[model samples]
Target: MNAVATSSADVDAIAQVVAAVERAQQAKDAEGFLALFHPDALWTTAHGKVLIGLDAIAEFTRAVLPKDDWDGRVTYEVVHTQFLRPDVAAVKVRQVYHGPDGGSEGAPLYVMTKQDNGAWLLHANQNTPVQTD
Candidate 1:
């Protein structure tokens, strides 16, 4: 975690990527969501399923995302961000699903890397369900 000040431009760019994720999830567009990931990205689902690399991630996402039966609207908010380097950031996100039944939440950590082309892509991410006692 770097204590140095991060550029607002970079922060804004990261926020855009997160927003894209929200849009994709809400639309059930697996391809759109996968577009934000790095080629070698690692992802862990809220249920603890691990997906390594874009290929695996894509396979799992394509299989499940579109077919998801949860009739809920999902929202993603970037809660915090720590710059590991100028091109790497660890972002904490607050995820919530508003459904007919009720609302459920997730805490996701997305480690994103800035590409040479000036795009921030998800590198490693973990989605953990926020259980209520």
Candidate 2:
């Protein structure tokens, strides 16, 4: 079995993982999105709060996609990375979601964790609303 990596490695792995997340979201591949996470992965949304376990995770993700305004595409950049431990890390990514109708929402901060399997997965995520006011 693979082991968790160092902090830097965790960051690198998560970078890719997050990218894959974007791709999966764009593709609306529910299974693909789920595949990036460990069986026991958890995600805490910015406003909706915590979604624990894979079933909830899948439900949340499915709800997001196929929305009347769902873009299914997200573009983002990693603004910061913090490591709480060798196997544990978090990333703040600046993200924007673009739906099929050309609407967009964003700058959400995404936090991720690298599991014992040496794969980085979404741990928690939140975003400040885009200032349009």
Candidate 3:
């Protein structure tokens, strides 16, 4: 436990960071997406590929983003957030991919760290596929 954020403004700021992620993804802008991550960030794909560092994430993203022609769109909604410290938070997101066929869901957890400059950077994240029964 670090420091808990007790301000509604902090919550709003965190929400902005989450929204930025969705915006970048929707535009397929690799640079925009990478800007949100810390240099030593970790990312685990929904398919379970673990990526360490921004470089690895950038490589993987560049390869996949350009090739995505799924004829669908993705939406990311912040479902919950918990502050671990004043500078760190865990955020859960509900992701939905709407395609021509139907829609698929994902649950992603993003661990964010607030910088000295008051910017929240993604430190670690994991995207999990939602299995429907």
| Residue 54 in candidate 3, Cα distance off native in Å | 0.6
lDDT of 3 by residue, 1-120 (tens): 455645787778889988888888888877898999999999999999999999999999999876657642789898998988888889999999888778899999999988899889
Best by lDDT: 1
What's the C-alpha lDDT at position 35 in model 1? 98
After the best TM-score superposition of candidate 1, give how far the Cα of residue 49 lies from its true spot, in angstroms. Answer: 0.9
**TM-score of each predicted structure versus truth:** 0.95, 0.73, 0.93
| Candidate 3, run of 10 with poorest lDDT | 1-10
Worst 10 residues of 1 by lDDT: 1-10
Given candidate 3, what's the lDDT at residue 69?
77
Clashing residue pairs in candidate 2 (N, C-alpha, C atoms within 3 angstroms) = 71-99, 71-100
Cα RMSD for candidates in order: 1.3, 5.1, 1.8
Scored against the true structure, residue 68 in model 2 reaches a CA lDDT of 56
Candidate 3 regions with alpha-carbon error over 4 angstroms: 1-3
Task: Return the lDDT, model 2, position 84.
Answer: 62
Error of 1 at 79 (Å): 0.5
What is the Å distance of residue 78 in model 2 from its true position?
Answer: 1.1
Model 1 scores a TM of 0.95
